[model samples]
Target: MVFLLFSAATSFAKTPLQPILPLLEAMPSDLHVTVPYLLSFVMADPLKMAMVSIENNLSPPETLQKLSESLTSLLPLLSQLADIIPRDALLWKLKLLKSGAAYANSRLHAVQAEVLFLASGKDNLLPSGEEADRLFKGLKNCRVRYFKENGHTLLLEDGVNLLSVIKGANMYRRGRQRDFVTDYLPPTLSEFKKTFDEDHKLFHLALSPVMMSTLTNGKIVRGLAGVPDQGPVLFVGYHALMGIELSPLYEEFLREKNTIVRGMAHPMLFGSKYETSRQESSRLDTVSMYGGLPVTPINMYRLFERNQYVLLYPGGAREALHRKVCLMSPYLY
Candidate 1:
C-alpha cells in the first residue's frame, strides 16, 4: 500500500531507462501495448515509473526489492492482456520476455549464491526458466527453482512465500567461525633465535669478500669499533669527486657490518648521453648498477614525500670538471 512515486521531470529520463520505452514501442505492430508494453508502458505513469526506474538503476539490494514489489503489482493486468491479446502481439511479447530473461540471468550470474529463484509462468513480465537454468548450471555451488505458479508479480500474488524463501536462504549470515590456541601463540626464544640466524646467513651470502673486508677494516681505521649491533644506522658522507675515493672501502665495511648505503647523484649526470662500445646512451643504467640513483626535478618532490634520506651536491658537475684549485669556503658561490 506504500506508494513511491517520482517527479514528472526526473533525471532517469536522460539515462539508461530512456531506451527501454522506445525499444518496446518499436516491437511489431501486432503487439500494440501488450506483453512488451508491460515492461515498457510503465512510462505512461511517468511519476511512478520514474521512481521505479531510478531505484532499478541506483538502489541497494533492499531498495531494489521494494522497487520490485511495486513493479509486481502490475502482473495480474499483464497476464490478462497476454491471454486476450492477438497472436502477432503475443509473439512480440514473447520477444520482450526472452530479452528480459537474458538481462536478468546476466545479473544473477554475477552474485555468489547457493540457490536461484526464477519465474517460469506468464505475467506482466517475461518468464526466464531457460536463462535461469543455464546460469544455475554454470555456478559452482548453486541450484535453481522455477516457480511454475508465479510470474514477474510473485511478490504481489504471494509475498509471504517469497519472504519465507528469502529467510530460509540465510544469505545475511557473516562472521568469523571460531578462535583457538593457533591464533595467539608467540614464537619461543629458541625458534626466534633460529629465524634470526637464518636471516643473518642469507645476508652474509649476498655480500662479496671484498665488500666484507672493506667494512671490517674501515670501522677499525675510523675509530668506530665500539658501535653496538642493536640496529642499523644511516651513514652520510661527503665525497670530493664524481666517484667517491672511499667508495670501495665503504662498500666493503657495509657488507661486513650487514648494512646498506644508497648514494644520490645529480639529475644532469643521468640525463646526458654517454658513449659505449656499440652506441651512445644515457648513463642512468650504469649509475643504477653501481647502487646509485639519479635525483631529477620530477622525483625530487616524491623523495621528500617518502621521507627518503637525500644527498645533495650544490656544486654538481661544473665544480668537479673545473681544474682550478678551489678553497673549501661556503661563500665561494
Candidate 2:
C-alpha cells in the first residue's frame, strides 16, 4: 500500500496540479494520460505540494470568496515567472521573485504627451530591443527605434543622429499646418516711393557745405528744409556739445528761413536753472514768435498735428559723443 502511494505521489509531483481546478472537469481518460505526462508533475511533486500547503496555511482567507480572489491574482504572476525563467536563463534558479508590475503601472500613468525610447546594442541589461518594446507597449502614441552599433549611453555616443531625429520629428509636426500667401506688392511699392523721396531730400541737404562742415567739426546746424514749406518734415541730425552749440544754430536757421522747426530737446536741457531763467525764457518766447517750436511734452504732440517741421536727434546723447572719432553710420532710432 505504501509503495502504491509513493508511486502516485511521484506522478503527482512531476505535474503541477492546478491550485484552482477548472469548473468543468476533463474526461477521465483525457485527465489520466495528460496529467501524468506533464513534465512539471515529474519534477515538482512532494516539494511543490509541501510549498502549496504552507502558502495556504500562512495566507488563509477569512471567507471562501477571498481565497478564490487570491488564487485568481496569483495564477497570472506564476505564469509570468514560468515564462520569464526559461527565456532569461540567469533567473532560473530563483524559486520566488517579486515583479515590477507596480513600478510599470506607475510609469504607464506618468506618460503624458510623448515618449522617446532609446536603445543601444552594447547595453547588457537591455541588450535586445524586445525589452524596450515590451515596456512601451502600454504607452499611447509612443515610438521605439534602435540605434545601430551604439551602446547603453546612446545619446552620448550618437548625439548628431539623436538631434537629427528630434529635428525631423519637429519638422514633420510643423509641416502639417496650412500656409497662406497674400500679395503685398502695391503697399510695398507705395512705401518704397515715399522713403525714396525722403532719402533724396536728405541726400541734397547732406551735400550743403554749412550742414556738412557743421557736422564734421563739432558745430551744430539745425534748420527746416523740405517741400510744401509748412508740411510735416522730420529734421534728423547729429548733436555735439550738449544743447549749447545746437540751440543758437536752431534759432538762427528758423529766423533766417522764416519756417517753424519744432526742436525736440531732451528734458535735461530744460531742467537746468540757467537755461530756464527769465532772460532765456524771453529769448525762447521771441524765437517761438518767429516760427521756432521749443518741443515740450505738452506741445510736442500738438506740433506734429499741425503738420510742422520737427527736428529730432535719434541718438539722444550717448551715440553723439560715443568716441573722439565718429563712425560714418547714421544712429538709427
Top candidate, metric lDDT: 1
Q: Please identify model 2 stretches exceeding 4 Å from their true place.
A: 1-227, 243-252, 272-299, 320-333
- Against the true structure, candidate 2 has what lDDT? 0.37
Q: What TM-score fits each model?
A: 0.24, 0.24
Predicted structure 2, TM vs. truth: 0.24
| Candidate 2 residue-wise lDDT, 1-333, digit = tens | 000001111112122233322311323432333332232332322222223322222334443555455445544544454344442242222111113333444556555555445444334323334444443455554434454444443443312244333322221122233111111011122222322333233643554324222344455555323223555666676766443344344434444554545566444332222321111122232223223332455555666666766776666645455555543433322
TM-score of 1: 0.24
Give, for candidate 1, the lowest lDDT window spanning 10 residues. 1-10
lDDT of candidates 1 onward, in order: 0.39, 0.37
**Model 1 RMSD, rounded to 1 decimal:** 25.6
Which digits, one per residue and each the tens of the lDDT, describe model 1 over residues 256-330?
Answer: 544323345554343212212112112233233223445455444444454433344555544554535554433
**Could you tell me how far off, in angstroms, the CA of residue 308 lies in candidate 2 after the best superposition?**
1.1
Error at 154, model 2, angstroms? 92
The local lDDT score (0 to 100) that residue 214 gets in candidate 2 is 38
